[model samples]
Target: MIDVKQPPYSAVGDGVTDDTQAIQNAINAAQAGEVIMLSSGKYLCGPLVGRSDRPLLLTGTVGAQIIAKPNTRTLLTIRCSASNVFQLEFVGAALTSVQPFLASSCIRVNDGLSGVVIQECKVSQFSGAAIIANASISLRVMNCDMSTGQLCVQAARARNIVLERNTFHDLGQSGFALHGDGIIIRDNVCYRAGPVGGFGAVQAGSKNILITGNHSTDGGGGFELQNENALSATEPSGSSCVVAGNSFTRTFAAGIDLFRSGVVLTGNVFNDCNFAAGLPTAFTVQPGIVPDLAGPGSGYQAGDILTLGGGVFTRPARFVLNAPSPNGGLCDPARPATNGNTYVIDMGDYSVFPTNPANVTGGHGTGGKVIYTNANIKARGSGYKSGDVLRGSTGTSRFPVLVRVNIIDANGAVLEAEILFGGYYTGTLPTEMAFAAYDTVSSGSGFTLLPCFGNRYAMQYSKPSMASGGSILGIGNRNVIVSGNSIVNHSPSHDCGILFVNFLNAPVSRWAITGNVFGTFSKGAIKRYNFGTLSYDTAWGAG
Candidate 1:
């Protein structure tokens, strides 16, 4: 063992002196597998970089701290495989403002390093993440205490990382942001972590992940699994993850929010979660879309149907163009139709459109005819499934009245429909009787081919005073197994114990809900909106 205070290169342990060069010399001279020890005193240091070949162990006695100098981006950077750091406290400027430390961190492990271990360390008052591992494999962080930071740990593009037995509290943002594959997070405790609109205590967007046996209290939310990149992509951003045996209490938002696919949730417990009245339920699967705030692209005449692109799980929305008026003439002053501003007359049954301006036709008043018209379900047709295509008989071969089915009731009656290609027809449009299946639209881009599954979850005492929302809510999930679960004692104003909703005409189907215990909810035990092919033992109550 090489002691930093007792060597040829002596490091001052006093809190005021800079011991950066001394400690760095010791680290550089130390051989592989040797120990570099620091005795209980404050060592003010700048950034320290470790070698990849000479793997060393850095440990400290009680009350030993490494204080970062002002304006330090990262205090320690490790690129060595099998390096271990233990029992050292990392202290930062504790700046209240996040601007100075947005890119700063206490410790960072570079990419492609493996077998790095950080244990029994305490990190506090950093404006950014305490520990960041980028593409590092087999990294382990255990028994650490982290508090008062933007985030505790961020492992991105990494693999086989294990975070166990850690304690996080009072974070400005989330405790952990894990975006990788083969991650394991177990037995962690978080309190008062995650800010509003942030991804809860733990935000996981990884495949083959296991988040089990964690406890969270009074956080923004317990956990969130969102693969925002998966939207409009051919492959899911996250898949084959399991979140089980976790407990969450008094969360501001949902206890668990799933916006990814192929996740299996089981044996999770939620209590008094979703305290924010207008938020989602204890468990939710609400997929959201981020639209380009800028107005739809320029050019095009009245009645042009355009398909948008970009974004994950992007819904297919048909933007029907409206006649554009000149800026100064025949238009209200407040809402003038300026040059290059194309007005969308209708956004049919979808929320997000593409942001790429090149997809739009330019130069207004091309004199393209407007043939877009609303196709209503004049009569509720039976024996039709959601996503079924219907064609109008009055339409010519080129212009077929193509409508996509949106929602269907339990009795197989079509409840809603969206126009896919509203063909031009001179005669009156045909009714439901004249409609028949022509061809199904390609389930691409906006559809989630893989769905989330939930089984044996326990939810109770969620949103005690809230007049809306359910105990467990899901959207666009498929083949769910909600069996052997117990839901009880929800607020009287609560909507239901379990609720499932569809998104943008995508069907929620193949749910097997059996052997679940439900008690006193205001609306019912289970409710569904645009659901399909559900198998339940008991009748679902009113919503």
Candidate 2:
């Protein structure tokens, strides 16, 4: 271990003298894996850089602090891999009024560094993020106390990052803003953080992420999933993630604002959350699909084949089948149909048609052939207006579906759908679909909306008396299991214990909401709009 106070490169830790060059010299001279120790006094320093080849350990005794001088952007920048910074206090100039350096950070890890650990440190009084990292891998930060910063930690394009057992308070923005994949945030506590924009204490967008055992009190919210980097299309943002075993209390916004896909939430608690009177909901789920407002256009007829287009990300083509016709011999004698019958057979509850016409045969009968001739609107896409024209694919196509919009709703949603041409489609539906004058591309990238497919177990919500929102609110989510939850002591003016709203009229299928207990809700235990294909059982009231 090399001590900074005793040597030819002596660092004067007197709280007033400039120790920038002395500290830099000690760090430069340290060999690989050697410990550079600092005693208990304050060391005034400007910007310092860690050696790339050394990977040295920087440690400090109790009450040891490195104070940033005026006009310093970053106190220390680490470019080395596998470096360790432990038990130090990073004080910035924002604590004082005169000559305060507002835009400063305590530490910054350069891009592509890996296996860096920062533990048991105190960081405070900076306008920018206390710790900033980009494009790093395997970074771990634990047992730290951070306060009085715009943000505690901000990371982007990083992977396999773990932040655990940290305490954050009095921040202007979120405690953590993380992006990329394989992130684990656990056992962190936040109080009075995320006040500026009402972002969650832990706001992240990543794939394969796990956020658990955290606590947030009197803050903006508990957790949110939103992409911080919009330009990176290849990165996974909020897909295949899990949020479980967290606590959120007395928050201004929802306890959890979930906007991504393929997420599982369970074993969490929201107590008195959404207490701010104007906020609508405690736990909110918003969909990412945008639909066109104008009605399906006028020029398309019943049998036309239309191609789908203009989504944020590319998806597999889907179509809805209608107006079935019977051909050949009768397949089922119980359900008799003539050869010219055009009425659609009741094909159970399935809405989407198979891609191949051969799969459309023998639903109610064995030998009778059923052909679906009419193509209809399965989903009305967004960003369309009245008078916009929709056309099918070109080139080797025989007849293309043609349509022009004529009517729209107050919010520009399509209300009337008319087909202008009855075109013939064979084999399978074409994969190309486009619109003229109504195509709007997605504004941001790294967002793809998939169905929610997971199990929720034993969550608790209690005492949101200041707002008129549901304890749990979901919009446009599917394939979820909500079981063994308890919602108690809600305000009488609130809507319901749980509420779901589906504006797009998409199929809300495969949802199992069961074994939930509710108490003293004004509306009921649960309420929904445009709900589709659900199993609701084993639910009761406590009082």
Candidate 3:
């Protein structure tokens, strides 16, 4: 028989007492098959522990409430298996806490638990997940009214979980961020899960999962599944996921985003979701967000996608590699200059004096990136390798922007590295963002050459320059299908609906990209590199 009753537990239910010890006492006293009932009132307290041995069922009425202390862990922790918590309001003290956002959880289910049920509860204002399943198995969060938290439910390294009949609204990140296998997320509704841009309403990186009959309205994206090699351990590459019968509305991003292969997305309603970046398609097998290509632009923020303006995998025009002298001035003349590659300079002094006033934005601090353009002492070698100084000078001052070799124009001499100044760079070494100085265009030589040649054979200044073919693609990835979605609006700031990029040198195979609907895109539907030529495919929503 379960010893179920109120009081004697010292739980006043007064709504204004520190009932931490009293509630803990009740949880401790419960034996196997026993339950503790709370009366109608608020129990302001700290963390509570549930045990697997006693298997306590902590039940509360509609008026019963449990609140976490400000700036602390979750209010309820259930690591023990077969533990059940029901019908209680879990409130986070975000209003009365000092920096509550740092580390706080409403409920956390630690690893190695089984058959844990959290049902019919209300969780609000938590800085972290309302329920986070960390390496736990067989956990069920059903019929819960969860709202106003950072990630309402997160399942990382957990398995065989079911989240159903949950109403999540005004969340901070994702309604559900899952990272496990054999998980089922159904009959869940999320409303503008967050205020700003984020991931999916139900996001994950695992296989054998089914996301069906779930509804979400604008927060970040609708549903995203990525093969994040860095996050997963068992299956680094994602596969065997089924996302169907889900409804999305104006999600501010793609309605369904899948970075893995063989993801079957059918019978999904994407209403105004693919409207992000003015795309008309509701499903994506690649990254749907337009990359933040680095160029002469301002107001850049962190996490912005930086890309080479027109270069990724082409035979980049090599910088003249006479090789820097031991003293850092002109190259050692013993080695001749390569005609097409050598960037010869008429140097008076190889001294680097910090005479230019430049500033870069969107880094560690305001203007932390040192900015430099063309200047005196302007001779540099292009024979790049593991052992090479990108920028060397006679004086103590160093070059501003390094690593970023924004070679402009075609095969011409005399570098005008001023293009590097127009970009916001972030790196460790001082020579990371700095570009070597050169002459201007009117000099019949102010040219932009291929700047990145980190690995090449000993040039002793051998190869002049390289003229070769390039490669681009309309889409990347393999064995994916995109069907039936709506995208009505697109941003005029960009020139595409969906731009596919290839970071790996792998081939794209067996891609069944078709049956997508596009609305108003700035430049047709999709654009990519076709061999060495820039090609545009009119398959806006479908490929």
Candidate 4:
């Protein structure tokens, strides 16, 4: 161990003098497994590069300061094996610049390095990331205070990296973002990670990542695990990730926004997420969907239901499948939709049925489902669980259909369903053409009108839409689980808390839910489609 102040180099840390060459000389003379120490006072310098074979260890006294000048890339570059940097307070040269490019990070562990440990370091006023690990392994960054950078830590294509007990405040981007494998961001605190947009405070797009025991406040949102399947190429699809024991408060939108599948999000807390416009839930289990809306054929509008039996029905519903499919996250459309076989598909609310069943227009016997009217939902407004069967009244298509009650928003609106098809589109033989009911029904027919003659609330609320109405909807998704969190809205705007819908008429299963609470939403707490097992582990709704 050689001290820079004691060597023949005799470096000065007067907080003003240029100490760049003095420190570089010590690093050059030191042998493998050597230590270079910087005593109290600021050493103003440019980039300090580390060695490969020597495995250098750089330490500073309690008040030692490294005021780094600006460079195109990082101020401290470590392209070596087993390099450790600790106890150094790095302030950008621009902040306090003996040097210019204050645009990069304090330290950058480059590719092909292993076993790097950086602890107890404080960095401020850099334009880019505080610490970045690219193609490095076993990189442990603990007990660091990083602020005012593009990103606190950006780790890409790395393995076995652990970031613990770090405080990232007011960062321009995410606190910790990873695009690699085996990364764990635990026991960290982030405040206002992304001041704008719906980005996550801790965003991951890799495999085997665990984000546990972290606390976030007033950020873009919390942990978002995504599998981005773009049109041209596919990025790394996150799989087998776990987010547990995390707490989030006052996020702009969601607390934990999930865009991938096969994740276990357990024992987390969330509050005040003004869920994006119509979609709800601080934690959403929404699968991505895409429309081939180009070239010769135009895309379908909101209520255009195309059935396999060469028929198209449009019964407008507030249906929006907001998640765009990842590169490989789509299954083939409703199969066996062969030509010449007539079919009628129903895209209605998940729980409440329509008010009239006799409204189905064109009924051909050898074909598919018969579109029911608001009358059908009016009769079954009590509620329907997933897989429960429902029968139309004698006046209408007296078919037995199965259904499931998937979603119930805060407004007490239920989805309309037939019992036999298990909440799916059913086909009945062509019998009667009830075109008048399908084409001439009045708007908001699904809502059960409240006879509030005085009209204390808004006119919209007096007539609450329910069953097969505009306010309630479902997109055909099968298996999903949104459990164990308090998804609420404290904002004065009355936004929804959780909104999960499916556009593709599909079936899913294997759901797990438990220990959850919800309340204080502007509109409603939960808005979902009747797709999977709707089980409640704990009591929810405004407590």
Candidate 5:
């Protein structure tokens, strides 16, 4: 457990007036966890100091106030040798020291440290970082309002840090600088900190992090994974990071910017941010000499499918889906879906198609009883010579019959027919029957039944199956349904069409694709990969 009591030499600072000297006296004599209790009053001070030799606790009454003079250094400076805790009401205290020669910070944890914990403090108005955790390990900062500083918390070279349930406001730099490894920053509200030309730049190059459930607004670039080229000489390997369920809106740039790899960006919201032209990507893989990875060639491999559900992107920007489909990259037979969510793609591209198409001449259509059946069946207006073999049958002949079918009469009065039937034979006897509409004898006369013309119609069992490539169905293993719950609008300036099953390069096995509406006003809808296992069959009818 914690050694909660101070050494015998520890002193107390009566907080009735200028408590700076009394607090310093306590710090000089005491070991860690020594409580410098303050009596209830207004204590004017430049900075209240503590040590990391052991843990220190500073306590005061509920109404006690420790006010720092303006333009002074940090209210509290945490050094490399001490791991202390400050429990007090700090008011108007600039956390950092102002003199250029002196170190300034509300709380500065210097390099080569092992552990420190800062909890349950109300610290505000530090000119520099409220809490600067530099090159340490296991820094646990929880339940603090670190506001009105140039940089709230500058975390560098730390590992296994937990920054939870803190509120940040009106800062200059990032809400929290995550330059450490294996950090968890969750359930924090950071607002109105950095939004100027040189405001709130996020820390660069840290790895194995999990950042989730945080809300940020009005900050310049919500969070960035900055890997400056100079610092990459000592480049920390950045991978296996997960950013999920965070919201970024009303920011100048990306919500969560990425400059590393193996980051699973799932279930986040990027809403109404100034992500217009030339803003950094919310998720970007920087260009470097490709590493010799074991499985995949590039950062993105084939057959890597993703499901984008339960998020919102309220700008007219591209939300990229990285699989191969027809025409674009969506060529897999396993049809994927964009459904079951209330996220709006108000004006952007949503179709996924592959880049190439494949050819297979050996696959023939399912044929009927004839030698070969073409798609065009009605031979009346189609070119057919006399004695053309419509269908072949071995049975004996039945007597011929006559019939007539037409859309209008020569007299122009609407023609009506009673019952007309013929050509009922059995035993595989192929017969042909054709009829035109019965014509009127004179103008506007009642229609009369004309003699059967020499027209020929074939009754046969031979019909070729339609090409499966053109068939888009959402049923069975395909599970493709375009329900009426979506609206897809494509601009006309760009050429577009829907090419299904572009995923042959990265084949899909089974899929449940339902409730997506695609509009192709200009550009194509779907494109599939050229050489992948992408097979897509749609059972749902297209709208």
Candidate 6:
């Protein structure tokens, strides 16, 4: 059975809530399943020593912060044989401890153990790692933030561990790392780590692992998977690993570095890679997300529609559809129903013909607004030009629409004006908000550019539908599609337009890049390469 109770000793500071006695009481009295809750306040105690054989927990008042003095060998040592939990905050002693001897770490999970969980705590500013799970223990650390320490979390020869929803920022070395099995890391945010000493975001060697939904920014390119220092026994180890839906932006090394076998890489975006530009393919691997493009009444049709998650799309034209039957072994059966293909061409622009949905509500539609007309005086301009400003019915004036220019004269003279939509004044020939810059003008057709070796353009908009600072969708285990997002106005120091990399050689196959804007990129946009099985749909600017 599980035990839950409070600590015995309770001591408060004079005019200061002294929690030293309270902590000792809790630790001494805690039974196998009891919890020792620390009151909210500063506990000016010396090093907290854990009682052997007593499964204990040192927690704090929800809002209460705790700090211990320095010179203590270990802060809240764990010698329990059974499963134990240490939640809240526990720090080393300071102030009263000799100078140059402040404190080492906030906590330590010591000696052979199993089923240990350390969660929801803020541990940092220590000389060593925030928490060190010494050799031979299985641990689960979830929803915690570790920063400013030599190392955030380190486990030597651990197993069955999971680290999820945690944040590691501004550290000297790796974020969270372990040597174990059944490890899964998801939805965590790591930034500005490594480059101080020799550090990577995550470095681990585990079997049957799943690392998904995480974002690593700046510093190192992202993750590294290595064989543990211990010699192998040839025991069918470190196989079946899946890494997906993670974003690595402005990284120095490759987005993900793999050193072993049987891993899969899909739907992970890498933007503005520094140390390792594009993907570096190595080892036995597979690319999980690839597009199956069969055309014109063939591949994916109306009935083939799937649910679409939100994200940025660089190319906006090439849509993926299914072809006629006999299509058995072509597509991966594990493809999720939520995948959709993206293309360039402003297919939603009304100037071409019938109006598409302007603002779709409910029933899963593009939740963004599209505004373009024949003229501003009549409604809105259907055309575009450089420097065109848009004046809405409401008193707000918008851009790229208001800066329209009429025919370029022989002498390079450009005529500028505020135009209306639909109808024009007599002999005035009112221009639309949209206008293609190059000389080629084709009526009834949206702007199309002949393929040029290297071309560049600029656009401005409010914001993208995806979250400002997070990954939108994850691609895992082969066969996927990323489509339809109008990305714009990206700030510097930001990486990615649409990223593709495979850690397990699950080389992304048959990918279709469509319908997304790449606005103001200091680095070149749409970076793609491979790390695993050499197969995938490789198309850039697919309009």
Candidate 3 vs candidate 5: which has greater lDDT? 3
lDDT of each: 0.57, 0.54, 0.48, 0.49, 0.39, 0.42
Candidate number that wins on lDDT, 3 or 6: 3
For 117-143, candidate 2 gives per-residue lDDT tens digits of: 999999976656789988889999999
Q: Candidate 4 at 370: error in angstroms?
A: 48
| Winner on lDDT (2 vs 6) | 2
Worst 10 residues of 5 by lDDT: 284-293
- Model 4 Cα lDDT, one tens digit per residue, 483-538: 67665555545444554433234422343555667665544465543323432212
Candidate 5 Cα errors over 4 Å, as ranges: 1-16, 80-82, 93-104, 196-202, 228-238, 275-543
TM-scores of the models, in the order given: 0.61, 0.58, 0.59, 0.57, 0.46, 0.48
Off-target runs (Cα >4 Å) in candidate 4 are 95-102, 197-205, 228-239, 275-481, 492-494, 501-511, 529-543
- List the candidate numbers ranked by TM-score, top first: 1, 3, 2, 4, 6, 5
Among residues 3 or more apart in sequence or in different chains, the pairs in candidate 1 whose N, CA or C atoms overlap within 3 Å are 231-312, 231-313, 232-312, 232-313, 299-362, 299-363
Q: Is candidate 1 or candidate 2 better by TM-score?
A: 1
**471-526 in candidate 1: lDDT tens per residue?**
45555556455554555544454456666555334445666666666666656767
Task: State how far residue 33 of model 2 sits from its true place (Å).
Answer: 0.7
| TM-score between model 3 and native | 0.59
User: Which is the winner by TM-score between candidate 2 and candidate 4?
Assistant: 2
Q: After superposition, how far is residue 162 of candidate 5 from its true place, in Å?
A: 1.6
Better of 4 and 6 by TM-score: 4
Give candidate 3 misplaced runs (Cα > 4 Å). 1-5, 96-100, 195-205, 228-239, 274-475, 484-501, 504-508, 513-543
Worst 10 residues of 1 by lDDT: 449-458
- Candidate 4's TM-score reads 0.57
The numbered model that scores best in TM-score is 1
